[model samples]
Target chain A: MLFMRFRHLLFAIFALASGAAMAQNNPLTGLLRSLTNTVAPDQGKAAATNQPTSVMGVRGLDEVALKDATPAPAAVVELEKYAASAESATAAAKQTGLQERTVSYQKP
Target chain B: MTNFRLPVRFGVRFGVLSLIAILTSVVCAPVSAQTFNLNAIGSVVSGLVEGARVSNISEAEEIQIGKEISARVLGAAPLVKNEAAQRYLNRVGTWVALHTERRQLPWRFGLIESPTINAFAAPGGIILVTRGLYASLENEAEMACVAAHEIAHVNMKHHLDLIQKGALTQAGAKLLEMRSGGNEIKQFAIGQGAEIFTRSLDRGAELDADSKALVYVAAAGYDPGACPAVMKRLAAMKADASSLAMLYKTHPAPADRAVRMEEDLGKLAGAPAGSGLRPELATKIK
Candidate 1:
């Protein structure tokens, strides 16, 4: 039982350490990417001015941000003559699964 | 100015008391989880001050105000006749709007026929991007960038709040006592709204909108760098070009906005690239 307790504690510590590691890996977090970074909005503001090209070095905008934005929920509006005939398109999407629904974050 | 400060002054005593309470909480509680929710405290404090309202414009009235402004825009420049492009823009815009706090709003999108690179967000949820600006977009990410900035204006209620404050300034406490802005006041506010749009929002608000735009694009899975990239393109343009005259007049320099975007841009660095525009959507944009 004592060994099990020790194993549990070890697991908990590892889990927490990994979580911190993920946060540390975040591109936005700067030199001080720890819990202490939240204390001063002013310092955050000051740090912001010199960030980007200064901190990260100048990089191509396209190559840099490729932010992994989560796939957008399918847009509420349908496509291609959708508004003109919503009922038909809705039926087509439901029945034949052929209507083209668009989203912001399309899977490549 | 007198009217502007009246509503806030009524809560001065409560505000001070809350300040003390906040300070005490900060001293006693841990900074993370124990930190007080300023919004929750605000609601509690507001519950005590029922009479302190700056102006009362219902959502319907706000929408009406926006429609009036939108109608004026349409009166000036007809919407582009490309139905496919129109629906495409709506699809992109509505998708971006879903990421915002005010997603439930009846968002409407339009592409007006103008060569000027401009976009406008009216009081409610009407967003119009000019054809010139639309043509300038290299891809859907750039289109989303334009839509998100205007959406940010609506989400933040920047223009609506400005018009509300303007109406109060003109009509004073009468707006408050009336409870809701009456039709007459609404019409007057709409007129003021037109004039306000002709000018520009304050510098801070514009920069705030830029920051919000970056976040919105990122949230919607578009490249957040699209903002700075667009700004860089604008920066390279001749400011005196006829198409850019009104845009230049109403907005701060593109270089300044690009500087403002740097902070948020840093956050986007090394992030996974989002999806590219679908081929059919790309064709519509081109």
Candidate 2:
């Protein structure tokens, strides 16, 4: 009876040990472990670096680029003309009814 | 024998119970303990459901999209014919961009021929300033401020984000169904993406870009104040002017921008003193 009891105890121990080993090797457990160990830290690092979350929404500037841009010669001439006009407009607007709001950058 | 059976039974029960406890703990742990695992599962499930939908735009992809947009822009208004002016703008833009985190991007700068007082930034580091806006600047510092502002938009991925959220998501979905039909869907998406430039970014984004532009120009050792100076100029423009209409529509009022810049200036007081324009570049602009 004593021998039989000892054998049963050993069998039980073996069964328990094997069960634990199998559990440790389980794919789900491995995935969970990797997610906790790897993905979490990567996210933390990305956050710390202030990386952008997504880049999908930026495509709209083409229309602006197309609609607003002119050929270089025309653009340059127009720019020169615009500058002269803008200066005169500023002078005119100041002399007339429009009030000029001065925005100065003072060191605080 | 009965005693042996009892010990074996108890051991089996204990082991099974421990396994159950571990499984339960994994399932029922506090969210903080399990969030990563849960997110992994969610990503896998989403990947399966969304099939080929890209969650992030790669750098190569950004360049491709930028190229398509740029071609359309060139179609609308070609680059300034002056090689010297183009080179000068590139030099200045590259100088400012080098000071940014995304310096590795293939930075290209152009002067558009438009008389409109506006600037544009395409994804993957393409920047264009209207000859009109460029001509209005008094010095390189002012030009740097403008370039920096557009650079900020690229760095911040402002346009890229708009495309992704609006057209790209739909395009990606369609591309999966019609693999050989991808080009048509992509072109349609690109057209839709271009339309976003006509719309205004949320006020917060424009203001944020202003703040970032200030920092970038200051970092590049240009007067951060140049940005506000430009804002003041824009604010002073007649709202009824046709040239000013598109700019005003797409941006916050210059008065509001000036106010924001005024607030930002205080924080930038400690930045290094800015340099003036190089004599050669000054003469070239003249």
Candidate 3:
């Protein structure tokens, strides 16, 4: 009876430990795995090429994006145009918003 | 001739003594007035007083006065036809106004119906830009530099402060008010203030206004260097003697203003490099 109870307790402890580890590794899991491989000379190129640019808040995620992602020239220009349009709209809205007074003074 | 000598000598002596006493009295009276009113310099020729309880002159009495003055001036002058130019100027003015320390002042902008290349700010936030000013401006920054100077006049309460300090006597204020057909009391206040501004003409008001304006211009995300360039254009325009009179009568001449503005520009740091002047938009001026 004692041996059976002890075995069940051990199994429960193992499961909890594995769960905690998985949660901690979730966001940065892929990046960590790739970095670990890069440290190994033979595995570096293979892992680096396969690594994704975007990840869910993983460590060094922004740096990975800078290294791995390439935006098309046309896409960049389109994004800039959108930004310019938004700024222009904001300026125009401010200009048209004011109430102009109609009163006038005569010249002496 | 021989019979008239004694009487003539006595008359001449009396005249000389009277002149000396009159000059002495004239000199002595102002010293007393100046001593009592530390702000006597605040008054203008129009007789408006400052230190009146009005929190904002432009919002208080200047608005009505500005509109009235703008209307009368517009009647005699012709409006510039370029809608885009008007819009552009308003945009620049608005940008500067927003960045100024007195952003809450209900600043109103307008293009006056005149050919003179000048801009003047009446009491309140009434800013009058002329067609000639529009034609001369190279960019938004230039427009703002001029507007900022006008804004300083309003923000500093140079006019209203001048009046309330009793720079214009009760009688002086009433006389000028009657001439302008405005409320004699209000006109009195304005005239006194105008006197202060006129006296400051040779003083540092214009240069100080220019420096203050550059600060606002830069804050509004425009290049501060535009101030010197705008003054350069004004200087060029002033070369025409006919144009000089109108511009000088309202605003100070551009002759020394540009040089001093340039000197100030050199001392300033971190002003932006280039401005985008849309010639297509600018040339739209009539």
Give the best candidate by TM-score: 1
In model 1 chain B, where is the ten-residue run with the lowest total lDDT?
A: B30-39
Predictions' DockQ, in order:
0.02, 0.05, 0.00
Choose the strongest candidate by lDDT: 2
Better of 2 and 3 by TM-score: 2
lDDT by residue for model 3 over A1-108, one digit each (tens)? 476447546555554444444432232333233233324534423432332222222221122322333322232122122121223423752453422111111223
User: Candidate 1 residues A3-85, lDDT tens each?
Assistant: 64575566555544443443323222222221122344354333322222212111211102212112111211222222323
Q: TM-score for the second chain in candidate 2?
A: 0.72
Could you give candidate 1's per-residue lDDT for residues B1-286 as a string of tens digits? 9887765764674465455554433332322221122222223233322332324667787777877776656555656778778776776677667667787777778876777778888877888787888888776667778888899888777787765554333233243335443554465456653344555688888887887777666666566666777888988999877677667766899988988886656654333444222122333543
**Candidate 3 chain B least-lDDT 10 residues:** B33-42
Determine which window of 10 residues in candidate 2 chain B has minimal summed lDDT: B30-39
Give candidate 2's root-mean-square deviation (CA, Å): 16.3
| TM-score of model number 1 | 0.57
lDDT of 1: 0.57
lDDT, candidate 2, B131-163, per-residue tens: 777778876767778888889899988886665
Q: Which ten residues in a row have the lowest lDDT in candidate 1 chain A?
A: A54-63
Per-residue CA lDDT of model 3 for B1-286, tens digit only, reads 8779866865775566555545434333332221122222223222343322234333667655544444433333434544555555665576567767787665656665554555656566667676666666665556767888889877776545544333223223333334444344455344332122222343466667777776666666556677777777667763545444445544556767777776665555544344322122333464
When sorted by TM-score, best at the front, the candidate numbers are 1, 2, 3
In model 1, pairs of residues that clash are A66-B272, A66-B273
